[model samples]
Target: MTLHAIRDCIHAKKVWDLCVPKRWRKHFFLTQDVKEWVRKNITIKGRLEDFEWRQWFPIICHNIWLAHNDRVFQGSLPSHQDTLVQSRACLAWSSLVLHVSNTVAMPCWEPPDEGKVKFNVDGSLDVTQNLRGCSGLARNHESMVLCGFLYRMPSGSILSTEIWSILWALKVAWDRGFRNLEIEGDCVVAVNVVIEGVGEEHPDLCVVQEAQMMLKQDWRVNLLV
Candidate 1:
């Protein structure tokens, strides 16, 4: 039983016991079929409060396989303590790389689900020229442009332009009876302010509040940053 030797053996079992949460251990170790077990553990969603099972699954399996190889070929293998340290190091490095890739990558545009429209908006500012504006378009699931708006502001912060764009887009959509919308913008601050609400002392409080109020109307709006 290669799977048993790699996973259920004394040394490997000790490592898994320390790494996997007790509450999830039953479901984690339930499957005995090799393919099903591998698929189940690797693709399992959600995580422990402080741990990530998705990353841990492969790391633990690789370490155990390495130890099994060492015992068979070299007649020597590191103690469970050494194996645990190596697994931790690998886990930390893997998590760091995952974080960096997620942060640096720009995801491709995905069409909205059926029966919904996606509104993509962006704001631009030229501080040197004292110019700012915002533009947005609504697209159907087929990527057909349904409606759009463009506005130029003589003077205002970039955040103001972004918030204004959202407000106007929502108003137009609501007027046209567009109830299901997924709004996207590159300005993280503006999106967060509208979705999470802003403080009274915030500079763009009024406009952000207006946008928030529109979102709370009898409509379904999703804000994506």
Candidate 2:
């Protein structure tokens, strides 16, 4: 999963996970300009899983260039409103494709079965602050809180946090004999991996395998989000 891209310009933008400087924004360059810059700029690459959102990068850049050209040569025929309307349509389609190919649907929190317990788990890693924490709480169908705990985990990749949080929660539930369990987490990838079971070649194989072994108990477990 080698995902590579060259970031040039879109003006200084503060977006999720990035803070682009003012002088580095795009210059309304043509495809050739983009291509040339990509060739010259550093090649940024990452695993396909982690960098999946980048699949939309080229298309987004193309649209930006088209909008620039239309404003300069077409006399802004498709005004800002028109541009936004078209963009929304394109975005909806792209989002669907992205979801189907490599993503999972986000889930909303809900209660478990009548006799079962719902375990809500979450992990956070503040890279800038070097803080990492994981927490889990159990609730019953009647909206009664049962047990919960918060623990500090080592700072690492998002996968680490996701795996650790759920893994810890599972252990707690198992020890307490909370057999019929519904586990929920915001990390869909981690949720799916735990639900479907992990493979030998996976990066977090050891921890995931341990979690899988734990899931084989006499309890019925379900994972979401």
Candidate 3:
């Protein structure tokens, strides 16, 4: 089966299993009711249900319930066909929440040796031609010593330059064998895109992908923008 099909199958099974628990159903309805009350009064998205309801109901029922109630709590109340879509969305949201929680909870790595290495990156763009330049600076926290500076002129759009700056900074950290490294950048968009793996509309996503691979290596790198 194709990757999409396989993933769908897994999500289906997960949603089904999640529905088997009686507690989940209770939580779903209770949360849904609470969310409805909130939406009528408050403007928050409200709390998400702790269970997956997507695989339990039919598509029409699912959509109708979602239209009338909060999707997370009311999602399982629908008919079968709609379950797959709802389940997949739930799974994706769950994964994102878990990832963000883990990322936030991760403690800063204590360097095996003394001193901390801070890497700062910045990008400049010429609005007229859309030409860009990226620069990165690495320094030691204790000594305030400038470890190195990386500069690159990326061809094409301004996005390419911002992305290249991050790639170069990561490369420098890997090469230097630094265990604890913090990266600082002024380009919030590039930093967030890299961290979240959300590539832009630009054609040069290959660079971003390559940088992501390098960043998955064994080291602690924090992005500060």
Q: Which candidate is the best by lDDT?
A: 1
How do the residues 13-54 of candidate 3 rate in per-residue lDDT, one tens digit apiece?
A: 344444434544443334334335323323422333433333
* Least accurate 10 contiguous residues by lDDT in model 2: 11-20
Who is ahead in lDDT, 2 or 3? 2
For this target, which candidate reaches the highest TM-score against the unseen true structure? 1
Off by over 4 Å in 1: 1-107
Arranged by TM-score, best first: 1, 2, 3
Clash counts for the predictions, in order: 0, 4, 10
lDDT tens readout by residue for model 2, 122-195:
76677887877666767789855555555666656777778877888788789767989988877998877776
Ranking by lDDT: 1, 2, 3
CA lDDT for candidate 3: 0.53
